[model samples]
Target: MATKDADKKDTVLATAKERFEYALSRESENLERMKEDIRFAASSPDDPWQWDEATRKERKNNRPMLTINKLPQHIRQVTNDIRQNRPSIKYRPADDKADVETAEILMGLARHIEAHSDADVAYDTAADHQVTSGLGYIRVIADYISDESFDQDIYIKRVKNPFRVHMDPDIIDPAGSDAKWCFIDEDLKEDEFKAQYPDADPIDWQYASDAEWYPGDKQVRVVEYFEIVEKKTTLCLWANGETSFKDEERPESVMAVEKPLKERSVMKCECRWRKLNGQQILEGGDDGKVFPSRFIPVARVVGNEYEVDGKNYISGIVRNAKDSQRMYNIAQTAIVERVMQAPKSPWVAPAEAIEGYEKVWQTANTANHSFLPFNHKDEAGEPIPAPNRTAPATVETGLAQIAASASDDIKAETGQYDASLGQKSNETSGKAIMARQREGDNATYHYVDNLGRAVRHIGRIILDMIPAIYDTKRVARILGEDGEAANAILDPDHPEAFTEVRDENNEIKRIFNPNIGLYDVYTTTGPSYSTRRVEATEAMTAIAQGNPEMWQVAGDLMVKSMDWPGAEELAKRMRLMLPPQIQAEISKDEGGQPEQPQIPPEMQQRMMQVAEQMETMGNELQETKSDLQKAQQKAWQEEGKRIKAEIDADKANALLAIEKAQDSAAAANPAAGQGDVQEMVNQAVAMALANLMQQREPEPMPEPEPPMEMPQPEQPPMDGGMPMPESEVPQ
Candidate 1:
């Protein structure tokens, strides 16, 4: 055992040391690569126009030479082997003899090529074009660099020699022998690679930014800087690669012209697939010694380009940086959330249907924002109503009794009960308990109920589900994280897991916390609308003897849930046995009043007198009050009428004042006033304000004193005189 233990320790140590060394090497290499990238980025910077120069120069070739305007008067001789028939191959100045010789040589070469070959190699010939002279070979070299994988370089043959698609196989591997796709650096055994030749500084992404990541842009978006004729946007990618945007006007190489702008608009996602490839090149020296100049990138995916039809689609990329896949996901998820949570009723439901269906409303807006649903639809092809929770054991005899077994017998003998079941059952095993009863599941999962405890159906649903799914999945996913996240996300059901959770004081709780799920349930899945929780209480049948109030309110709720009333006998029995307080609540809930709840004779008599006096006084007060309210209302109405009349008179005067102001303005400045209505407007505004301030509104009248309530003596006191106090009269 000791030997085995020692060996295991040594193995662990070796593994740890290897990992540490590997990590250290990778860090050092990355640091060096990063430094070179920083230097190159600083020096060359990102020349957005660098490729433009190459693009312009790459198309046509122009050679510079001076024309012999005035020739020197010195005698110039013809070349020794010049053709006499051809235009005299001579120069006027002897100093310019070199040009004469160059012309002779070109004529001789032309003759030689025509004599040797049938055709003098006119560009883009059909036959014999494959055969190339030394001069023709040089042109082929240019095509090699121009050819791109995505954009094939093509050259037309006849009327117009457009760019053609051709790739020089030599670029990849001169011979297709032993070509490898990926490679790693030989010096560093720790680092990995992907190409046959590994570049020191390699970039992964073609484009990136500190810009917010918008997954929604894939759906609907405006064209990039769109215009009628064209559109463009300046996109910057800080990468280590040589990248180019394919010019949409004359699309070639990648987006070549044959794919016309009229057909379709283009969209692309350009990642900064840049690489920092380092090379040591000699600067200047006769000896030709080498030194590192600076690192440069080989390739990159830059801003995308597009060309819309001039009449139809101004040139630009259609969907800037996003694609349709993302849009589809959003649409799917939104549709699912909509269908799953459509309101049950199109209009307000009757109160009868909603009386006890309190929690049913919570589903109205519980849009579970994900792309999954229960796959339901009404016959009319619309979404079904809503998620009405399934009730327990549907309207039958309320399974009021639970079967007990040997375990229950022992517990009963000892006068103890399981907390899950309440004490009302008093069921014994092999006799009152129906010990043979069990469900379709495995025996290990079945157990006899012990009385006096309450088992909520919802809680049981959650508990039963845990053994099958989420608990295991959650643990697996958390463990798959950075290892430390495991502690925060592990099964709180385990005491060991709780040990990892530290409180504010950094003290570990050691014991598992049951409230974890309860708290999590509230925070993560709160109801969208208000919902009253349905309390369930099934008397864990064995132990009802010890405690009746164990599941008190819950039991009554479960019974009064007589919305499905097949279990009338059980409810009746439960109600009869309930404590007085519970009994009263039950009565009220059942549309009944409490037992013997009524007024006594003396109190009744007093109440009658008070009511009678109130009624008489109410009648008298109504008559007087009606008169006063009507009079006040009428007076206010008359005042409003007077005010309206005044307003009308003021409005007419204001209009007349405006007209007068206009006449004065026109007269004072005849040239500017006919169309200049400013004076009239000012007068009108002033007069309106004056009129509004001058008129007074009617004020509200003070309320009349509340009418007095005088009691009518039950017995008119023989002469209608007031009765004396109880102390003075005979009691």
Candidate 2:
């Protein structure tokens, strides 16, 4: 058993050593270049200006090897801009199982975690390194909230030194999300190593002979190696549309005798971390301890990444500016040397001219004298000329121009011109100046953009790990976009994880289970909450000044956008003063129920009386309308009866006339038959009836008169619920 244990230990150590060496070999060239870049960017006292050793040695005797580093200023400009406008993580639902409210809860949780961990320091540190040495890193780690607590919390930690980490060279993603393995090294003193791990060997690994990995005689190197391992397993798709690995222990609902809806073989990936040295694995060895997330926790933020001939290359803002910086240094040094070599102003004259005034002339340049009394003539009695002062030589114009050109070159290489660096420029218009500044921002935007990408990846890693790390029910603190704090109850086992409950503020607080949904992450870089508030305040003030009426409607919003101590309270008071309709809308937007207007008792009584009176009048008006309709209907019937009576009278008159005509016809013609007399009477009757109908026209019925409107009682005023006076109300 002892021999088997020893063999297993050797196997683990060998495998770890092999993977570490592979990563080191692949990253050797890039690492060397990165080190040089860091050295150049840091500009430390050792070789701050990157001067050649021989040149520096020679200049050490008598010359100014001044290092006026202009790179740091430009670097700080970009870094500070990023700091002012930090990138924030946002979660978006990617599937039907995910809801917007839950996504929001996830986003808030991420923000809270960031706040708790002081993630700004991590992000800023990584960005600084990216802008300086071309590479930066941040990693997600799970740790117990306290030594006594069993629950774990996830944190985003900063890797202060980029050199301490080595990643897979095969990773093609600029964010390093595709990396298969990574190594983080730590050098411990020999005694410290023994104290920490008494059972582990303290000797340096044979593979880690490189001085860079092993910290010499008294120290030992220990590596934290993270690798992704894959295992094949049967994935069972249940009838309820849930999936789980067949080998995993599940609840009775999942383990029921009912056959699975489907089954398939799938590769499951796990991220495993281990601590090991040259001899054996110190922690997390063959037992296979794994992180909950499948993805590697380390996130890489690179300034600029590309591939050439199948080899990856990384560069930063300092890469191209190095040449310009060196040139600027050289030019400055040359100018200084020229100035030192140039002679001072001196007097020139014949020997006899200053014979008597030698002492005075000798002290002329050193002191301020009233006058110098020189000899009028030489010993030969000839006219002696006064001492003539000669001008000192100046630095060459070419050297000055070179220095200026070098300075410009540094600006051009860094993309931070005079306008960008806050220097006065020829641009007189604000638009033109802003345009020039934008040009500089556009040039350096990649560094900030890359930082955003890394942040987004970090968000993804954290999101993936949340389901496992925060699986239990607990109350978690969440933050709003404006940094307002709120509490959320996370219950993964609940049937409805997205149900909302009212918070202390009476605002809807959602129950979240990060484990319930599929979500995607993205990042938006913009001005911070405070900065945005200032901008909003300025804009609103301008608008209020331009259009005073806008103040009456949006005064609350304007005040709310302010950052003063009492602004929120003031805004709340102002909101109440707005029109009820507008106030309702604002209340709805704030996720609160609209309030009902409160009426005084007297006004309420008056309104009730007015309502009773109005109802009585409405009933009376309805009755009046019904009576008028019935009367009009009765009138129509009477008119019809009168017309029928007139028609009947006409018809009777026609019949009488026909009878008389028939009797006359019969008396005149005794020989004619009775039938002929009857026919003639019928014809006469028809003729008479036709004439009567043609002579008289039927009259049209009269239209009914419209009903008069009833007078309504005056209503009480809604404004301040004021009651109308009794004298003004209609009786």
Candidate 3:
């Protein structure tokens, strides 16, 4: 027996060592992940991979998370348990009740698998990059010094803001497009360019000022941005809005070339500087002759004449000064840079418009994780009134785009666009606060806010670089154990796709709508777009619960995308491309590190008071569970006593009586005594003979829904028991 006990102890030690090694491996994986995270934060000061601000905004505005997932929540809870320290070891075979040991082993295997990740696919890209050259349109500001003209106080202003991007005809939009990627890494404004044709109805034109024809001594300003190469260039202009208000019969704009007399030179400006005197103030202004700058002349100009309103008109050309700091706030490119999501031109809607459609079409936003839904659009532009505009379609499957511009098209938020149509201010409209277009025909520019960014206070990119932050391998490993983890009996083969549910069905309601989605446009497929949307929304909800943190982080990155311009929103977007639930679990697991206790004086005092009592007793009783289980197993095996021996002796005494009954039964009912009939009766009688067999009776079951209360009167007496006045009684 002593030798056997020694052998058992050795076996237990070996098992403990194995478990310790597994836990150590998990810790190592965790450390590696932490390193990766730090690394990611570093290289991408704002966005890793240099994704432009436009691209970031466009992607965030497009890709939303399917929040409302439970996987992430579970990971958070369990990881927190591990971090608290002293968690229960997964299994102790017979020591556990039921199959808990097996369940825990399966969990361990799952954790082990999650400790690493393997997602290779990427999605949600913005437009691709293209070269950009500035253009110029002139704004003629006439000071009424002579008052002799019929235009005194009547400023006959002519603006020349319609300049073509002039792309080499060869550098086409994956299609025939002049527009470049307004947003990061996306295609340019081809749609808007298409909308510019005279017959095209998708016109994004706005009349600059008031009036129809500059009648008399009107001044003309032409601002054009061109590379001005030897090669021929195309001059692009708006069709509807750029026309001179003074002349209603004329075209809005026309393309022209440099005249032989006018000299073309590269426009230049002195660096911005201020006037300063001996006391940082000059009598009139600071003046430098030999080494001068502030007052130096910047541009060269040529005078010219042009045809408009059916006749030629005189105009002054701005050789330069339009591209100065004085004009930085108003350039269309600058305008797009300031605004969150950039559109190639004022005529066409932005990528945000397309993205908004998908968010609603895909997500089941139970937790309001707009995390996956369409981001609101900016709505600052003067929208074309209806009858002039086509409406967004609707679907019964709850898939369709909202009419609400992120700025103020409330038809979306109010759920009125699906009907004949109703609208109001949509507060969620980001479009309203858009970075105004600086150079459409009558274009104006406005200030755009740049989101703040720190300048790498923590300099080491490698120091902060971390691997995939969240995954569930640690928990999986804790669950299963075998020479190979999956072979451990508890590992389930299929995990991510959960068709059957552990809880009640959380089905989203489908409302009636007149429009459909991309699914509807398909020529051949399983279900209509409407049906697909319903399914997608349901899946999104389930997946969301698995990782709300990823959803939230995705939203944050979106704001930054809107703020940053190029390659800024990349790192955050890459993080979003991961499976949501796994990411959440990873975050929770890493975040669950036990904080050093900063116990308050009051709490510390109480702990010290009880230290000699409760704590001391606990320490004294720190025996391991293995010692107890072994002792119990030994005791059970030793006490193998048998009750069957006494019962067997008693049965021998009753055998003679049983034989007598069997013989009588045969004599009493001779007709009933078929072959072996007496034997059957004897067998049953012998079985029920409790005194001889020592058998116990079965317990009775409880009745269902047994009545417990007595009945009560149907009605009670009135408040004063007033039987005196029937009129006063309540009916």
**Candidate 1 per-residue lDDT over residues 155-182, each given as its tens digit:** 1112111111111111222111111111
lDDT values for all models: 0.29, 0.84, 0.27
Best by the TM-score measure = 2
Model 3: residues with Cα > 4 Å off, grouped in runs: 1-311, 317-624, 634-640, 653-731
Q: Using Cα atoms with residue i matched to residue i, what is each candidate's TM-score against the true structure?
A: 0.17, 0.76, 0.16
lDDT of 2 at 455: 96
The CA root-mean-square deviation of candidate 3, after full C-alpha superposition on the true structure, stands at 40.4
The best candidate by lDDT is 2
Show the lowest summed lDDT stretch of 10 residues, model 2. Answer: 207-216
Candidate 3 local Cα displacement, residue 218, angstroms:
43
lDDT score, residue 206, model 1? 15
In model 3, how large is the Cα lDDT of residue 87? 13
> Model 1's lDDT to the true fold?
0.29
In the order shown, what is each candidate's alpha-carbon RMSD?
Answer: 47.9, 11.4, 40.4
How high is the lDDT of residue 583 in model 3? 59
Model 1: residues with Cα > 4 Å off, grouped in runs: 1-593, 597-606, 677-731
